[model samples]
Target chain A: MKFNHRHVLSMEQFSAADIHAVLDTAENFLELNSREIKKVPTLRGRAVINFFFEPSTRTRTSFEIAGKRLSADMLNLSGSSSSVVKGESLVDTALTLRSMNPDIVVVRHSHAGAPHLMARHVGAHVINAGDGQHQHPTQGLLDLMTVRQRFGQIEGLKVAIVGDILHSRVARSDLIGFQKCGAEVWLCGPPTLLPPEFARFGARMTYNLEEALTGAHVIILLRVQAERMNSAFFPTAREYSQRYGLNSEKLKWARKDAVVMHPGPMNRGVEIDPSVADGAHSLILRQVENGVSVRAALMMMLLGGGDRPRGDA
Target chain B: MSAGVREPVQVMNRRDFGRALDRLAHEIVERNQGVENLALIGIRTGGAFLAERLQKQIGKIEGVKPLLGIIDITLYRDDFANGLSNPVMGPTEIDFSLAGKKVVLVDDVLFTGRTVRAAMDALMDHGRPTRVQLVVMCDRGHRELPIQPDYTGIVAQTTRSENVKVRMKELGEEDGVWIEPPRPRTLPVAVLPPPAKERSKRKK
Candidate 1:
């Protein structure tokens, strides 16, 4: 289907076929990766804007790379670098950018569904990079794509997503994507972080790190938000790590070929042990690399071009 | 018989068609000297099946299995919203490592180059490959994007009013290529205005 001029707001809208389509396109993209000229003029005249309210080096760069590779003109506007510090409201900033007549906007905001709100005001297609703790759909998709690449499929694989769950948008999006792909999901964190009603999504909740890690084909380590400590949610980083950290010994309980993953920037010794992060089983870097491919695929599909014909709105 | 109706016709037979795949496979190996750092990724359905066959043929000639992957390219397609209902997703399989490897994009046909364009966008999610080359079973003439196939099994010159169909034995009963005329475009229904008396009564 034609993906041109579409807004990607959440994983809730994705179907199994949509997931398969993106993965299939990404495969063809891998084939195109060998040329000396790593760019195509598909979106040459199109303008894309990257509006990041939150601090992110990896996601922002991945979106920028995807735009540039497609030969689209990309503009990066971070809160610190933009007019937001100069007293520009989110809506005002969105309006100002909308006046520029961009073809697509990739937005990462501190508030949940900010991209959705921005979509209402702008004529360009909106991509939700991350909004508060609401959702990071692209990250979730890339994570799923990475897992699928390694495992050949996502059906019935036991996945343990450990660490901060309550305040993590990545966790929320990951849960949806993993479940949609037919994997059995488990949410493990401190009781305070793990919500009581997570069973609604068919995920098993746990406080014991050992039990959670056992027999899991994939172990997703979420970075513990240090700011959560200020609220007295957890006593200290060291204490939390001792109880929940994914150390080499703890990883032993997981499947032998279990792939370790984390959304960066990693806290090294906080959420996950250093040995495990750097271990042979770690697919952390692969996840980052896949982020670009997945984002590029998303941009292309959402922007325009695919198997299906463009619809008349 | 309607004034605008036309019949579809067979284009290429099995013997001539097998030669095309064989030639394309030879060209791929000749260009790369082997399939060592290269990968073959096909679009879903037909392209994917073709990629698997090419991998087998290339393996026989070069003694190496080129890394194979299948892309659904649906969510990434530009016209995703045109359908009446939400599209169903399919399996995307790429088992080998994509890091720093040369990739060969395989497809059953190359028409407007839009599919290849979408494929490129999807490829970035996996990893950065060292290089990428386009390989198609049929390069039907109709250039919408600035894309050219590096290796083509058959370069068929056809009009925009004609459709090219490549059927593989794995997915279909017959392994052959067919050319068919395009279906007639339907006109949209025009909305009629309300009656003058009813419009005036509403205003009053």
Candidate 2:
């Protein structure tokens, strides 16, 4: 009930209390996910539509599974399959989907405010899956869940996000989301990819990866997002790996219990070493697992009973 | 329980609550024939605490402990779309398998029979038990489903307008049951009774 947002557009909309409410709800779903019979009849008659204007495997499949586990009728629409390929406008597409009467809409788009635009046109609760360098709210929430589960708290913890901050929507969401939860956020990458203006976002910007990794509780390595970048930001992949990539040696710079994380489609050897990606300290896979639960919690709150008037009253 | 109106008529004091559970425990042992493969699974929040107490009472009587579990039936409720104002979820902990076991589902109150229905559905999803029984501390009935408690502690005849409040020691309230009478006609109705026709149909 504390999380009474009509739509999950960005982490900016979530206050510290709202974030905690979501993470607490997600804890229940995490237990459900561990069950032998994971399916629940919470959203039996409701319909959820996943409209991805961009290509995705982990996020798309995660949402699909989350919806199905709740017994919701799930419809997946990809860029190649939808009439957007036939020249339909985003608003027109949203209106077209609106006619089908979905209860919730999960959207991912290449445009920055595409989810916002969809939210404007549709009555269904709109959740931003990801928008072009704008936000990936659920990803931010799942990362928060992972960190909270590991550290048992988020306040006063040092979270270092490494790699291409310029084009990564995950970075933007994590920066705002983590800071909202009272975590010290540090951004590290090459100077071109990590700008000085990022300091205005209340995060400590660093060109030297060691400075960011030192004494950090969480180290999140971001994907390069080459598709979002038109020109080269770094000279070579080898040079970037040698300098910024988190290997066994680089991992030692953090606290003894420091955990490594990645918003995946991980270029195994680029932003992070494969050993670290598959290491005991890695929460990358846990992030994916928590993704399903966090998303399910969001859908349940928005559609189930978060806004229902008290029948007893 | 919703706040505001007062004048609580005490139905069962703390001593009566203890005595009812004692009798309910005896009946359960007699019916189930010495707690062989028996499991007590309580519905969350209220029933969960009752289940734990029942487990202790049953253990004291039989000289053995029955399997215990706690279930949150929020996810399986019939009115997920509207009935509950804020659905706060709890953990459904059933560590042992329910197969071939005589499971007794416990709750604090039995109202519309909908919570029992939801609990049964949730129980099935965990695993099918050989036999399942219902137990309630209070059966203030307005039966909407074809369900009845196998072992009941207190059966109070309550009006549709009156709300039954079961305060337990676990929740920092003295163990007792109180009936809250309907609000005055000048104020808007708090808990509305079901239509007369539906009530008659339920009785049938």
Candidate 3:
């Protein structure tokens, strides 16, 4: 199949082959890391905009790195820093950016489907970094890539995703990604945080932390959104951590090869015990590192440089 | 089926294959300064196996283990809907850090560049890398996307009708390369010219 111009707004839009193409291209791009000159001129003449309506450190930085590596001129527009304070609507903001003739626009918004809406109005390729709790397709792919790299294959791997699944876009994206990549996904959290319909996606639901971790091949711990506590989902942070926290003792229930991962801004003592988060099995840092390569791959593909191979071959 | 033409199947032997991988490894190390702050990611199936081999060779030469990642670009392909009844996903492995690291993307062959496009989508969730370079065993040409291989072992010029097959001992039973000629399609035989007499009789 041929991909000329396309917008990536959701994980649902990807087919198995589509996913394979992105992964394969990223694999080839990874080779660039070993070079003395890390930057490539593939997307040098292209322009990219990082439109983030939500505050993010990891994601924003990753997209910036990806754009810079591809040699595309990058623009960072944050809601707080931009003219949104002057009363510009998202549609207007997107239209203004589109007028700038960008080759790609990476968006992170607080509203679900915001990227989808923006994509309809833009000539540039739109990449959804995160949208509310709906989906983070790129995050899902990178998480799957991380897990697969640790383990030879994802088939039949027992993966337990714990913490605030209710407000986690990462959880939702990882759920889809893990299941699609052949991993058995398990969702564990308080009843309020764990939706009843989660099982429909082929994931096993559990409220007990120990049981969820039992013999699991991979453990993905999502960051607990403290702001969501205002709704009385959990009584207190300490109480919540006691019931569902992944500590050293609980870590023993997972398989020997079991690895623990977290999407950053980690609450050291809340969602995961410090010992476990810093332990040898923790791939948390690895996740952060992979985020760059993955984002770079995404930008290259969306900007039309991904399809081209690098160097003087 | 095309007059006197025969389908071609040319083989690339083991010694030549090993040399190809060695050269790729050397190129990767020289480019990235001995694998420090570097990673190797492979496409699923053959690409992943090739990445592992390259990593092993690079590790021996560099004296430091390079992070190896495997990616399955199944959902990122362009022709996904036309191929399968149900999507078949492969594994993606990248245990090492990607942030601020130079990444080498390894694949068996570079053809239409569709696979590399998908692999890029899959790589983003992990983190961000300092850079991404593409390495392939064979550059078969005729790329649909603007993608170009950074480090290509061999540049084999092939027609659109030709098929390139890469076999590795880790994934396949043998290690070799084969080029096969495209098969021509036969036209459907006319059944009595659609019964012209019947059509005229019906008209009468």
Candidate 4:
């Protein structure tokens, strides 16, 4: 099948086959990463723009590494720029960036669906790094790649996502992505942080973290948005951690082999204790490593080149 | 009536394919002078199988195997953008370096030499080989580049209007070469020429 879309705007844009293709491609890139030179000229001389309208360290750095590894001319644009600070519209920003002739644009914006709008107006392939609380596709995919790598298969696995669901773009993307891959999903947190409508996407919702962790194959802890603490979403950080925090004792309820995952900037004492975060179950760093491979795969797929790295390049 | 179409006709069967590979192995060793510093790299899919078969033959004769690599030149092709709308990526599995070794590049057919050109380009990326030799199962005429096979099993003469296909036993049951008829052109029928019978009648 044709790689159905050019712009990777959301996890919703991916079908099961699309996910499979991404996984398969990511595997090749992982193999490539073992080489001594560890570089491919597939995107050599092509221009790439990391147009992040939101602040990020990992996603932006991972994308920069991925593009640079492919030898693409990469430029990073964060929200702190003078033009963006002067309040130029997203359309104007995208048009100005497009004028510089980027072959691909990785956009992370505060407003949701910003990448989709930029894709419609520009000629470059737009990869949504993250958009508000809507989606973070690459993170969802890297999580999937890491899980699939550990379990040998995604289908029939039970994945439990604990911590904030209402405010998490990661949670939303993962719920849809895991369901699409045939994994059962459970969302656990306080009712204020857990959306009932998330069950509409096939994830079972519960308030009790222990109930969610029971018999699960993978447990993902999302970092609590501390900014939301001021908004009365929860009574306090101590209460939230005491109720939903993943400590070693609570982790025992999960299968012994259950993978503990967190899309990080970890809150050591809040959503997860330091012992659990640093324990054997943690896939935090593997997720970061897979992050580069998965992004490389996505960029390569978007460029539509096969295994043949450019000869002259 | 024979007017409608012409089908693919098999030229060399599976047994002949084996014999050809067996002979090509001897040729490769003879040219390179006893496989010293020799390595074999196959162009993916068809050539990979051929490379392995050659390895087995070389092992049987020389009592050792040359280093083996398989290259998939999809990304290296010149028409990477315009030619393939959705290309399925395969891995380039050259684990060892080509520092100063004599490399033999293998493929099923030598047609336009584009595949070989791409393979050479891909090999240079791994590191410069001291020498590179081309080994093809079939050398069908209609060259678009100045590339000729160092060792060829069969020379199947063909025109630009025809297509040549090479199949291996590893891929399926039958192993042979087939030539396909040309596709019909899309030019308007109004630009006319008299039929032979009509020309004879006019002459009479």
Candidate 5:
């Protein structure tokens, strides 16, 4: 019943059962999330240091709030402000943080496998927030958690992940995570954005947004990589919206119960219409809210508990 | 099913269990004066079912159903460092507010009262109820915290070495109170019958 690994560095490290164990734990913690104080003394004296080598207000703040909610001693260390700004090597900065004797170090570096590299050098548990375009396990987890809460089941649901598929770590992580959860995933966007290799993870690729939207239970619109705004992904935001944007009319063809999701900081009118993003079916805010619980599940499992065996938990 | 399967010695039987809940429901209605602002919230799995049964009995008397909610105390336990390897969570549906409501909390068994402590903490976090009353099928005392149930269905005194399990038929099992003595190698549970036969069989 225990999650075998100490560090949660990759979704690749998980099986469907392991992911189920995590989602199960997160659902349990959802009660705490609903409370007024929204806190539990589960990790009272434990220290969770959020080391983000990438500038991220959203992910870092979510982890910070999750830690604080669990009554953990949380410390935030961003790359620009930390010793990394002084040219300290990744390993050096990790060892320095290790000397503080923290219980966990949640590392998010721009270089892929940076968190994995830090885990080897540090005694404390490491959770990968996001590393390069490799994997953002928690983001993927929070998204899945939101969908599961709304749909009651992830199995057999048609999840359409649209926009900038090639550059999205969220898409890659979701592809692996959702497929493992038994959902049929459809990768939708321009041909350049929707790479053929994504099919290796069991997602069907489609260039037609309308085809992906039809019969889909969940529509996940990725933030069009701002860098892609200049590249060959699409000609312009106007052209892209007319084709791939999840506008109100495009949403009409989706299942009545179908939901719109974005790993936010949305390009509102670009990838999604403001109407649909704020629409009753959108689970964007809930996805953000679930981040806390999913992160709490990860920290609790990694630090003191590794998925309770059979009973008592 | 085995032919002529004999019934094991139990603290309470199906009919007695049903009668106890009916009595508890009457006690709740009488004590609360009426179901005016009253609500029933069950701790998940065990308490939730008992709450439903209690609601049914109360409904028969009052002709009106009290608002019902659920609390899953899995994440709220104080003994996270001990046992709790694979903590399974259940649904907590409280569509109504606990604010200004007289809430009756229900559970199957009252052991160390740690679960009650967790449940109270979990419930308070949701919203402050004008009043909070506790109910349990069996009050098996071990008082780790200064907590007690208000409307007790049965007070079954158990030893520190025995487990009091309230198996319900709602889960397709039987309804009875079966006490379990400490196993040769008991898991971290304070008191639970020798791990079910198949579970302990695997250990062998």
Candidate 6:
């Protein structure tokens, strides 16, 4: 199982074996993360540039920590801070960064295929941090790692992803990733938020949140993309909370050992109840902690010769 | 010998392997002057198994168990950028501090000494040891780095290109040391493209 892809732009690019490689490598990094001196000299003398054209907290910090931990010289440039705000073309910016000879370029943009465009222009390996509503591959990977840590294996488990699937890059990536691992994926939200087209992706779609949560091993709550929504997707926040939001009452619909997850910057009252978010079943913080390990594994694969075939001794 | 395949010449049998380990374990204990504050850190895969066996052997002799740890040198390899294939990473478990302990770095086979260099650097990251000693079951002669094993079980002279395998029972192999000849390289079958004149004729 060679992780031959130089640039990780989507979960669609990952086969089951390739996903295993990432997860397996991340497992080692998870151990490294728990070390007293949580750092490795793997990517020494390598340069990494985190170019985020959108706002992020967890993703940016995770990538930064991962690079620093691997001993890679890291440079972070945000949309407001960089020349992207000055009307510099994406290709020109990428070319300029390429001239500086960064070994890895992590891109986060509001537009879809932005990282793909960056990869086309830059010689450095490109990792799509999050490209609009298209894909957040690393987040999907950490979620997989978190679930795998809890359950040991991903096969034959029901994963229910609730809320705003239409405006979520996480939804797209997780749907592909979980299904690839042989998990039955269920998408549940309001009709406007959950499209029937998602069913084409081999996920079971349900308007009733209770039905989706029923017999679920893992439940992932997506943040309502209020910023992306232009019109009313639901009657009100209160009504949506009562219908689709995962509170203590709705939690009973799932199995006794059912674990809950949320891609962070979560709407506490609107999307999930605070009690459930901080409950025993919640793996939200564990997912955040695994983010660094997963990103470190990605950097090691792309820059540390992890993806290449073994050369003769 | 078959085409592109090399046969291994067995140098040590299962009894020889056990005797070598028993001797190596005794030597490590004698050199360190008792097992107090002595920790054994093994390199991953083969070295890890050898370290475990040595730990038990030493415990039986000295009537006290030493602290044991395992270090994976895949991250610390200088050949990382040189396109060495991604080695499957195992957990590096150094739970105890190396601050005051006499660390015995154990390995199965010492060839390039590059692995030892990486292992030492990896060990330092955990904590600085009082003193570090190297121990190996087999020391096949090929030193890329200026590093030498302090306590060697067997020293074998071999060409740089030869492969020395230390098969262990723990890794699902019979205990033995074998010198394997390099595999014969197969000639690549070249595929010639059609001539330009033939291509022009095909267009008609």
Best candidate (score: TM-score) = 6
lDDT, residue B1, model 6: 21
lDDT of 3 by residue, B36-78 (tens): 7888899988788889999999988877878888876654555
Model 3 Cα lDDT, one tens digit per residue, A1-313: 4443367777777765566566655655665565444565556567888988899988999889878887778888898899988998888887788778877788999999998878877666788999998999888877877887888677789999999988898999888877776778889999999988888887899999888999999999988886875668898889888998889888999998899999888998998999999999999988877777777767655544342211111
Q: Which stretches of model 6 miss by more than 4 angstroms?
A: A228-230, A306-313, B1-7, B186-204
Query: What TM-score against the true fold does each predicted structure earn?
Result: 0.72, 0.92, 0.63, 0.88, 0.82, 0.94
User: Distance (Å) between predicted and true CA of A43, model 1?
Assistant: 1.8
Please give, for residues A1-313, the per-residue lDDT of candidate 4 as tens digits. Answer: 7685777889998998999899887877776666655676667778889988888999999999999877789998888983989988877887787677778889999988898888876678889999989999999999999999999999999999998898899998998899999999999999998888887787798998888999999999999987987778899999998999999999999999999999998989999999998999999999999999899888878887322221111
Question: Which candidate wins on DockQ?
Answer: 6
Which regions of candidate 5 are displaced past 4 Å? Answer: A1-5, A24-35, A149-152, A188-196, A206-217, A231-258, A273-282, A303-313, B1-8, B62-67, B186-204
Residue B170 local lDDT, model 5: 92
Per-residue lDDT of candidate 6, residues A61-105 (tens digit): 999999999999999999999888799999899889888888889
lDDT string, candidate 4, B1-204, tens digits: 233227876778888888988899999998888877899999998899889889989989899888899987765676654436666767878888898999999998899999899899878878889999999998987788999999998998677777778887788757788778887778766767778899899998
Q: Scored by CA lDDT, what does every candidate get?
A: 0.81, 0.89, 0.79, 0.86, 0.84, 0.89
DockQ of 4: 0.21
Q: Each candidate: RMSD to true structure? A: 7.3, 7.2, 11.0, 7.5, 6.9, 3.9
Candidate 2 ranges beyond 4 A from true positions: A227-230, A306-313, B1-6, B183-204
Q: Over 4 Å off in model 4, which ranges?
A: A229-231, A305-313, B1-5, B35-37, B183-204
lDDT-best of 3 and 6: 6
Identify the superior model by DockQ, candidate 3 or candidate 4: 4
Model 2 TM-score relative to the real fold:
0.92
By TM-score, the better pick of 1 and 6 is 6
Deviating ranges (above 4 Å) for candidate 3: A1-5, A305-313, B1-204
In candidate 4, residue A170 scores what lDDT? 95
Chain B TM-score in each of the candidates: 0.84, 0.85, 0.83, 0.84, 0.83, 0.87
| Error in Å for residue B185 of model 1 | 2.1
Q: Answer with 1 or 5, whichever has the higher DockQ.
A: 5
Clashes (backbone N, CA, C under 3 Å), per candidate, total: 49, 0, 81, 2, 7, 0
- Model 4 chain B poorest 10 in a row by lDDT: B1-10
